[model samples]
Target chain A: MSSSTKHSKWRYVLLGVTAWLAAFMIPQAAHAEYGDVVINNYADAAGIRPAVFPHWFHRIRFRCKVCHADLGFQFKAGGNKIDMAKIIDGKFCGACHNGEVAWSVENCAMCHSGVPGTPTHFHGSTVQSLIAPAYKPLEGK
Target chain B: MKNKIILTSALALVISGPAFSADGVSAEEVTASAATPEPVVVAQVAGANVFNRNLKKVKVKNAPPPEDGIHDPENEGTYVLQPPLEAYQGLPTSPYGNYVDWVKAIDEKKLQPRWDRIDSSEEAFVMDLDVLREVKASVPDVIFPHRQHTEWLACSNCHPAIFIPQKGANQINMSGILLGQKCGVCHGKVSFPITTKSCKKCHSQPKPEDWTPPLSEATLKNPWR
Candidate 1:
């Protein structure tokens, strides 16, 4: 009933809210969504689904230079003007994903999972375990 | 005399007040802030002052009769000359000639004509810039053999200026090239004219289906070599 007690309760409520928001705002290393780069250059506005490029999945297999330097990909996401037209032309992402290389470019939903409720194909506990033992966080004592 | 001095000072302030107020900004600085290029300024000045709007009314001397087809008043007498086919004959039908033969000949001191400075006197080095774009196009894909071009021109002639080195930066197409952009900057003018039915000169290689991604360095090597 006291004013000091009321103020203490208010402070606790504010701290709890702050902690909850921080959990969502800060990027988590273990999560697949952490390094996801949204490529909405022409997709979102044009009614097509924007692509969510998973950096974490690709980084495990290939070096940065393979895509960035050798393939002439701009360092920043969406920096290179990528479109379906150019992709089909065997440029940009199409360089490696041209059916014969890694995966077919025809598989749209594999990358274009930015639409709400769209299930990401790579998000699973089994895939997380496959990320190698070195990348995992240190365990508690 | 005091009134004359005051009037003169007022006139001087009116004449140079903006320049002084601008914190050392010159006339060039004002124009440069707009980021206008020198050629645009020259054109505007020439149109407004030198040539004047009245110049359009004046009749040009020895103007060709209207009956002449394809008369360009701007170029006047200058004509786009077709590159002689004889110049390319006997040269390797393949891009950059036979690289091995040329190198072997060089070692034996029997390389004919040599990689001489015909287009430029400066030292030019061979570089591979073969890019495979438009694989599905009707004709063969382009293998932009730099050795073929570098044999004549310098690196400074194209890099970072005319053609940006970044891949996919320059959207090259036949229409744009014909419009004097990209390759048209020189091809139609100083270099070989594209209209001479020399399409195969560049697009010589066919699209290799099942062509592996991450082009192997072996393919990048001089095909002639």
Candidate 2:
């Protein structure tokens, strides 16, 4: 085959490959899934891991208006002025967690357990992991 | 060659002059014809846009009025608030199931409210029971006329579930209600669209003074009998 003809054939093959790759990449980019809660406020400021709240779990227990409207929680994270003192005084977490309505705040280490160099283990599993175990089939007969 | 060229030019001018001026056309005629076509196209586009806008408004207006009449099962999906309780069967059970089962089931077309159908109102009355109770402990239990509501609803509309069959069994709380478990199923979405009037709807009762005619008649007739 002539050199020019060979070059043209190779160019067509490259174009085809590029077109195929472009089609495949578009959908993945468009529908990429990301974590719902991105705690950029406290951690980025103090160089530590800020608390990551999973909406999927909390929503199961209570309604959005109960906390948002009734308890005065702001819509955006970091917007609400949450502090340890208020929680202990039964303002935010204390409202329910006074050992009656929900989990108590007596165990400070539950939320603030992280140390500087040691690896921190937040006890509860992710929403997916917690739900997955519940759905497993019963053990063999 | 020069004589032939001159003869051809003279013939062309004579032929064109008569055709160009035959009806004595003016510049205005030429301009008007050119300008006319542009407006017709612009008018057509404008008409199309108006038609689309009107259609959108109509669909939106019609949608919520009917879905709002009955309880909404999920936060998602289109709805209206009409009466006489049409059911939307086959919806999955709400993760939190406090809504009247009839209303919830209606979403799945499983059950229908037993009532006559009526046009839903754009404006809804709000009933805030909390504030009402604070004001008067002896407040009359609001006699919500079920028959009136059924004019636009069905039997399964608020039965066998949303309200427990055993009267007074379902003690609704704010926390449980908000999770779309109990009364929240219909209040926020359908059935009088709960608001400030919610208290009046559920709590307001017929007063003793208001009961003069019927009670007085019975009392006078029987005495001690």
Candidate 3:
């Protein structure tokens, strides 16, 4: 009766990260929503806000391969090693961000609008959610 | 970013929703797309960011055709078209893209997605193989169903490109997907955003119970055959 194990705070962090907010967030609306990713790798050193990739905005218009395959964008957030140089040179995001395809990379605030201290991750989705048999505190054990 | 270019010259392209024809779409893919793929730049103002606002949030979803972001709200002609909310009525729903369960609808014959654009008579080269990626210690193994994807996509869409078409040829993991490499390419983007609710959707294979491998006869201290 005395065998009680204390759960770590990190576990709660994972739980909070994956906690489904849509159930409570939806206020009488059947809307479309996709995950957003935040990339902060370079911004920390570059003295700029983290970039917020609205994947849904792009994905809605093209196939996954167009960016991931043809454009050579890595699937993971921040995995593309994006920078202004590459964008100006027309590499990763510059492929479409150019004024011709969509918008030019000169629009810094467009992507770099993310919060200052965000980590590189899928905005709403977290690793703990994708893993099966997701952690659940045993009920009334 | 929500500026209106309803009466502009580009309205024709914007109204049809071309340039971003949404791959894996159903049979209704009108070859309205241009030769070179481009963003849906139908109504962007000069010097303006393509997406001026955050992508995660939408003010109104599935509104009437006249008021929907893509439609020409000022034009009375646009109002003649049925609203998405009405069209989506009595259909299967999901918590993702358009909130329609297109897969279930397709399976139930309510939707018949063609396999090709040029060949109307062509049947999908549907494959039924399921590859299991084992993840021991925690989480169930992932079950890759070829049939579901092949029905919507083609061999060229993935084979030897995103993934090699051979056993043990490709390396896959959640990290890569989270990084937007493997399955992350489509999922968590257009198809279905990754969520805790969908973990079992892909990670479907049940893990084997705790057990040891079969012991060799030599290990039993008997003359092993």
Highest TM-score against the true fold, candidate: 3
Q: What is the lDDT of candidate 3?
A: 0.58
* Candidate 2 lDDT (Cα, 0 to 1): 0.39
Best by DockQ: 3
Question: Lowest lDDT 10-mer window, candidate 3 chain A?
Answer: A132-141
How big an interface RMSD has model 2? 20.2
True contacts kept of each: 0.00, 0.00, 0.12
CAPRI quality of model 1: incorrect
Best by lDDT: 3
* Candidate 3 residue runs with Cα over 4 Å from true position: A1-34, A128-141, B1-93, B96-143, B147-225
DockQ pick, better of 2 and 3: 3
Residue lDDT tens for model 2, B1-225: 445544554554456656536767544453344444443343457755655533211111112211321111232221211221122224333311112233334335443322111222222122322322221234564454553333333334345556654645656654454434465554432233333434565666545663432345676799696
| Stretches of model 1 off by over 4 angstroms after superposition | A1-141, B1-123, B209-225
If you superpose only chain B onto the true chain B, what TM-score does each candidate give? 0.39, 0.28, 0.58
Per-residue lDDT, model 1, residue A103, is 78
Error of 2 at A119 (Å): 20
Sorting all predicted structures by lDDT, with the top scorer first, yields 3, 1, 2
